[model samples]
Target: MKISDNCYVEIHFTLNNEDNEVVDSSLGGEPLPYIHGMKNIIPGLEQALEGRVAGDKFSVTIKPELGYGERDEDKVSIIDAESFAGFDQIEEGLLCQIEGEDGSPQLVTITHIDEEEGEVTIDANHPFAGQILNFSVEVMQVRSATEAELRDGLTG
Candidate 1:
């Protein structure tokens, strides 16, 4: 069946950066599945997958805005180093999860550690933000979404 709203789709995809570095892939793993037009995946990828059928293959490039949103300087901030006391050590470029303003867990990358001042700088932007995404994808399956799947925004 062709992919359409609420249709369950399974796709094998390899995602790369503008530099051609593989950012992620489902080549050897199980195909990734999602409910079409439900925002289960990025807007660009989902839009590109629309109307495709099983066995279809295509490539697409997504701008940062459509991918992860442009990196925001406001998303970078410094907090008490004590927040990471649970860790044996904290260093630059380390990814961790911290509570966001709404009390939800948010992923952040440690960009700097000031041991002398007890401050840790973190960037809350998604690691993929502000970057172009190049994807090579193959449709593995396309079928009507089950009642439960549609309601739950997932697939079996």
Candidate 2:
């Protein structure tokens, strides 16, 4: 069947960056499965897969906005190290959760650390932000979604 909203899709995909570096791929593993219209994948990819059926193979280039989105300078900020007092380790490239202004938990990556200055630079932007992405995809299977799968927005 053709892929459409609420359908279950299995695809083998290789995602690459502008430098042609493979960012992710399912070629060495099992095909990834997801509910077609539940935002399980990036917007550009999901749109490209629409109406495609099993055995379709294609490549798509997705701009930053349709991928991880443009990076916002405001999302990179320096805060007092005391904010993370309880944590034993405070180093660059560390992923941590912090309470946002809205009181919701937000994931942030530690970009820099100044032990003497007692400050930490945190970036809330996605790691792939501001970059174009290329995707090579092959549709392996397409089937009607089971009621449970649709309700859970996933497949077994």
Candidate 3:
């Protein structure tokens, strides 16, 4: 059956960045399963998989807006190093979670650290933001989702 909303779909896919580096892949592993049209995957990929059936193979290129979205300068900020009091070590490239405006944990990566100034620059943007993404995907299976699966928005 063709993939559609509420359907259980399985696919094997390799995700690459503009640098032609493999960011993620399901090759040599079990096919990833998700509920079609449930936002289980990126918008570009899910849209591309629409109407596809098992055995379908295709490559799609997604722009930043459709993937992780363009990077926002406002999302990068420098804060006092004392904010991370509990952490023993504070270094560049360290990833940590902070409370966001909505009271949810937001992941931020340490881009720069000034030991002398006691300041840290953290970027909240997604790592892939502002980059093009390429996906090579093969539909492995498509089937009607069970009632429980539909309710949970997952595949079993």
What TM-score fits each model?
A: 0.93, 0.88, 0.88
Between 1 and 3, whose TM-score is larger? 1
Whole-model Cα lDDT per candidate? 0.92, 0.93, 0.92
Residue 151, model 3: lDDT of 86
Candidates ranked by lDDT? 2, 1, 3
Shift in Å, residue 30, candidate 3: 3.4
Tens-place lDDT digits, model 2, residues 3-97: 99999999999999999999889998999998998999889899999999999999999999888899999999999999999998878999899
Q: Which candidate is the best by TM-score?
A: 1
- The runs of at least 3 residues in candidate 2 whose Cα sits more than 4 Å from the true structure, single-residue gaps closed, are 86-88
Q: Candidate 1 residues 1-156, lDDT tens each?
A: 889998989999999999999989999999999899889899999989988999999999999988999999999999999899799878899998888989999999999988899999999999999999999999999999899998766633
Residue-level lDDT for 24 in candidate 2:
87
Which residue pairs overlap in candidate 2's backbone? none
On lDDT, the candidate that comes out on top is 2
Clashes of each: 0, 0, 0
